[model samples]
Target: RDLCADFECEPAEFNGAANHVHLLVNLPPKVALSRLVNSLKRVSSRRMRTEFPEPARHYYRANTLWSDFSFAGSVGGTPISVLRQYIEQHNRPV
Candidate 1:
């Protein structure tokens, strides 16, 4: 997918049905999160429009696919081991 290819990252986790998609990416520290998300959104939207005009035309009828705001945080104090475990268990069967 363009998201994986363009970002130089792999989708660590992917699970969704019908309307929504959830993705987890283990990206490199060098990649700016904001820049990466923005680029993915911009490029993907454009490509989708070119490939599927109908959906693209009404895609933003609700105003925008995403809001003008986003949430971000650093795991500075979290241990690598702990973080990995947390991510791994995040969406696992309960």
Candidate 2:
């Protein structure tokens, strides 16, 4: 979706648990990590509120959804296959 159009990266895998979501994306070289995270949070928050107004109203009080803090890391030096396997294994069932 937006990730594909905006960053030229499609999410390879996605999983969500109680308090967090895990996404595996293949990012283009020019994309900045912080910018990507901010855009994702902003866009998804807005879209979620608009598309699911009842749920958004029940859960959130403000216009924003995500917290200000985020965690990010580079996958450099790790084999892609191994990383994919790791991400696949760690996901919690919905």
Candidate 3:
């Protein structure tokens, strides 16, 4: 949430499962989505590595903590409640 605020975005909902996370953020038109994602990955990766050096070293081979690709979509006419439920309930493969 703090991270989103730093990028001028509001995190409507967030959840993590398996190897991926779901985040429904409200972004301003001027904010670059790619930049925000990269910043989030960089900051979190650095902090996590500092807190858990052994796991970071053991699990990562090329010092890469995040994938290069990301998915972005508009809420459009969807209800916020529905989006929140989906994020909270959906699980991904490891």
Candidate 4:
């Protein structure tokens, strides 16, 4: 994705539902999470506006495509396999 290329990060995995997405990104230590997140939100918003202008314009007219708050957790201690499984599981039909 453009976000990864701009930030010099790699997307190890990606998944999503109707309202949200999960991205397992591998980025450099020098890149701050806040900055990356801001870029991600910006890029996503731009793409949404380009791809689906009507809804994005209506729903995000006042705010943004993403919430002001974001949930970010470090997985320094978690195994990649487990993380992959957990993320994959969330995408399954409930």
Task: Give the best candidate by TM-score.
Answer: 3
lDDT of 4 by residue, 18-75 (tens): 6777878888899898899888888888888899988887768566777787877667
TM-score per model over all chains: 0.56, 0.78, 0.84, 0.83
Q: Show where candidate 1 strays beyond 4 Å.
A: 1-6, 16-20, 61-66, 71-94
Stretch of 10 with least lDDT, candidate 4: 85-94
The global C-alpha lDDT for each of the candidates, from Candidate 1 onward, is 0.61, 0.76, 0.81, 0.79
Better of 1 and 2 by TM-score: 2
Better of 3 and 4 by lDDT: 3
Query: Taking the tens digit of each residue's C-alpha lDDT, what string does model 1 give over 1-94?
Result: 6676677876555543334434556677878888877776677667777787776676555645544565544556656666555555545321
Which parts of model 4 have CA positions greater than 4 angstroms off? 92-94
lDDT per residue as tens, model 3, 1-94: 6888888899888787767888888999899988888888888788878998887776565767767677877768988999998988877523
Report the candidate with higher lDDT, 1 versus 4.
4
**Alpha-carbon deviation at 21 in model 1, angstroms:** 3.1
Give residue 45's error in model 4 in angstroms. 0.4
Off by over 4 Å in 3: 91-94
RMSD of every candidate to native, in Å, equals: 5.4, 2.2, 2.3, 2.7
Q: Write down the worst ten-residue block by lDDT for model 3.
A: 59-68
